[model samples]
Target: MWVRGVEWLAAAAADPRACTGDWDHGKGIALLEAGRLWDVLSVPDRLGLLTLDLLWRPGMSVPGPTLIDTAAGRVGFFLPPDPSAGWKGADLRYATKGAWVAVPPPYRPARFLEWLVPPDGTGTLHSPGALAGALRQADGALAVLAPLCGR
Candidate 1:
């Protein structure tokens, strides 16, 4: 079943021009053309999870707003509006490379770990306490999915 899915994805990547819809445009289509859909999905998850862990550790301060480059212009994403939001205060901004965006003070860090793992002993993707274990499981799942995705 997985092999078949990979074959289908490969075929889709081979001719992304056929993709037309709100969800398929610009870089998204280009990624398909490059046969990078799997990587596109997985790499960000890995990076986001790692970044979350880094942010969650003790003594870690909130990161400034992030700029994600786009053809239009620079947009800023901030981690937190204030310290009270805990780890849920992050915001994402889009923008072009080399643009400088102002980061407000008391920014919140990402809660990827919390989301992926979970706290409260009751686990949900939105919780943080289970991050380490969730990450381990995610790694295993990714390993299995990688081959199926042709990664």
Candidate 2:
């Protein structure tokens, strides 16, 4: 049942078979296009962590699914499709239309693409406005601390 549910979640991929085929073949990960079911907002691990902290603080709501690429020192947040969002940052990358994101089975443990906050198969995604606001706050906090930390 869990496998079936995970497969259903995987259907968000542009090519569901390719994703399941790779998993069935033991590849453990597959590439899925963005801007169809959702988009991906990627930021450096440091800033991402800070943003997450702020998002989940005492009175704040928890964010949607999030992934971390430890090997690349980056983190990705799953957000609703917004091709014209125009998100910009010094070390940020937004995967919109025509871009791809490597995703792992929702329940499986991955090497480098582990999920910090796994999806619940509800198709819930982060709000672009809330995320942008949190990101800006996190970035500003980082800038303020960078000098003190000698960065």
Candidate 3:
């Protein structure tokens, strides 16, 4: 099933400059899939012609928040900014099972949510659970399409 998805992704990439708006965000998913599965996990957003990939992963799980390594610096997840507040900026409180945990930040937390790919360079952050989620989502889609394929 993944093989089929990869084929589709490859076809999409063959065209010069795939547009996320043209295909609902499938282009970013294809880009993420092209890399090592565990090395990249991102949610792509379309802003005009550019796509913003929001990537995250879990770090060490502890009583407090876990720290994630990013180009900017290490940022926390799960842990809230204030002990009184029940939620952090956008970090998932409880990431999927086996997900790494990151310590929560105080101000402009998502700033740590840097660009997944720089304008002129290449690199991606690896998050185990995020990768798993992407795979599962892709697989689930295949499962649904398999019946329609008549095989």
TM-score of each: 0.22, 0.89, 0.22
Clashes (backbone N, CA, C under 3 Å), per candidate, total 19, 0, 10
RMSD of 1: 17.9
> What tens-digit string does per-residue lDDT give for candidate 3 at 36-137?
112122222221012111232255221211233353343322211122322222222333323432211111123234222211111123334443344345
Q: Which candidate is the best by lDDT?
A: 2
Q: Which stretches of candidate 1 lie over 4 Å from their true place?
A: 1-43, 46-129
Best candidate, TM-score-wise? Answer: 2
- Model 3 lDDT, residue 47, Cα: 15
Write candidate 1's Cα lDDT for 1-151 as tens digits. Answer: 3233223333333342343221233222222321122111112444344444554467744332222223323222222112222222123222222222221111111211111321111111122333334445655766787899899
| TM-score rank order | 2, 1, 3
Q: Candidates ranked by lDDT, best first? A: 2, 1, 3
In terms of TM-score, which candidate is stronger, 1 or 2? 2
TM-score of 2: 0.89
Error of 3 at 133 (Å): 0.5
Model 2: CA > 4 A from native: 1-5
Clashing pairs in 2: none
Model 2, residue 151: distance off in Å is: 0.3
Q: Which candidate do you rate higher for TM-score, 2 or 3?
A: 2
